[model samples]
Target: MTRAILEPVDADIDPRVLRDIYGQFPSGVAAVCALVDGSPVGMAVSSFTSVSVQPPLVSVCIANTSTTWPVLRAGRRLGVSVLGEAHEEACRRLAARTDDRFRGLDLHVSGNGAVLVDGAPAWLDCSVEAEYPAGDHTVVLLRIAGFRIDPRARPLIFHRSGFRQLVER
Candidate 1:
């Protein structure tokens, strides 16, 4: 059978269409947090990935329009929490544009000021390594100084513009 030709994407591509296409690929949600002025400031990011093993580096993409990122990045250290299945509400709160994002949540603050969600599957204490400007977003590289994991916990997944739970067969 012959394959049909597909249209080439252009710079003027619709953002909604791009978002819908991106949402089709499932990804783990992460809470990137740090203590700012003795308060926990954080945001949820689905565009998080491990970049390097030798240097223990990870990456998270933040929208250029994000107001929280500027303040969060100023902190000496940041906590990257791989949100678990039970963290749907937490993720929502973190992503919301509210004054108190960490309200009604269990948290742990490292000595270096990395604020991590207590029940998350994994936590990485990291510092900003580098930042690169991309189209409408900034790709941030983080250097992991320390990390922890819970073997039994399941990660929260983001797909099709919604939260999803893992179903093991």
Candidate 2:
């Protein structure tokens, strides 16, 4: 049986320590994109996850203070791009808070105008389903409308404190 990971008590723990401990688990990198008022907005996230298979659902969380998030969550379809090793630059661009995320990026619009990252390992065309506040962030759930997997590309992975290419086991 699984036990509680953290107790509801006054305990001291450094956030950086927590992040380092948690980051030990390797995770795939993803970028969530949406267009607000005709301007493309995006954010790089290592927290993307598949929530449900029956409903074709996926979720990504964004910090409440994120300037790019509100623009992306404003009621429009968004693209979920699972990055490949070749996408390191794209990830950096999207992750930067003050830089042009799309500069030097080769992307295009899909049916609902999501800024799809070209040639990603996988791309999901989805519409926002719901959002809920979670502590310092909001988790946005999406209903996957469609997806395309690039059979030729290797998926990107994040571990410790950096990116890595996923190799065959």
Candidate 3:
């Protein structure tokens, strides 16, 4: 089978237009959190992805201007909670610019300072393995140390600038 070949556009792409085009594909949402200075710091990211299995590596791309990433990165370990379909509110709260991101959410703090959100479909305790600058965002490589999964949970999704859930066919 042959793939379609497209011609390149002559004009520069608009960020908003590019984002809208990229949003056509759905992605699962995850909360990246850690206990920093006795406070839980977290953020919702849709760019989380599995990188490798041999080293149990995962990755998340965070904007360079994010204040939360700096705090969360300083921790010895970071908690990656794959938000379930029921966590739409929790996801939004985590993404907010409030003093306390865990205000109304159920969470558990690990001995290593990873803050896991309760009811998440999956949770992973990881350490920052590597980081690289990718344009305006930073690519964070996480080396998973430990993890847990709840097979029954459906993951929360982000699509076209809206929250969504996986559907069973």
Question: What is each predicted model's overall lDDT from 0 to 1?
Answer: 0.96, 0.86, 0.92
Which runs in model 2 stand beyond 4 Å of their true positions? 1-11
Q: Over the stretch 1-169, how does candidate 2's per-residue lDDT look in tens digits?
A: 8886974534576778878988999998998887777878888999899999999999998888998776777736889999889988889889998658899888877868777888798999899898999987889888999899989988788899898876678
lDDT of 3 by residue, 60-153 (tens): 9999999888878999899999999999998888899988678889999899999999999899999999999999899999999999999998
Model 3 pairs whose backbones collide:
none
What TM-score does model 3 achieve against the real structure? 0.94
- RMSD per candidate (Å) reads 0.9, 3.1, 1.8
lDDT for residue 62 in candidate 3, whole number 0-100:
98
Q: What TM-score would candidate 2 get against the native?
A: 0.90
What's the lDDT for residue 124 in model 3?
98
lDDT winner: 1
Per-model TM against the reference: 0.97, 0.90, 0.94
Reference-based lDDT, residue 123, model 1: 98
lDDT of the structure predicted as candidate 3: 0.92
**Strongest candidate by TM-score:** 1
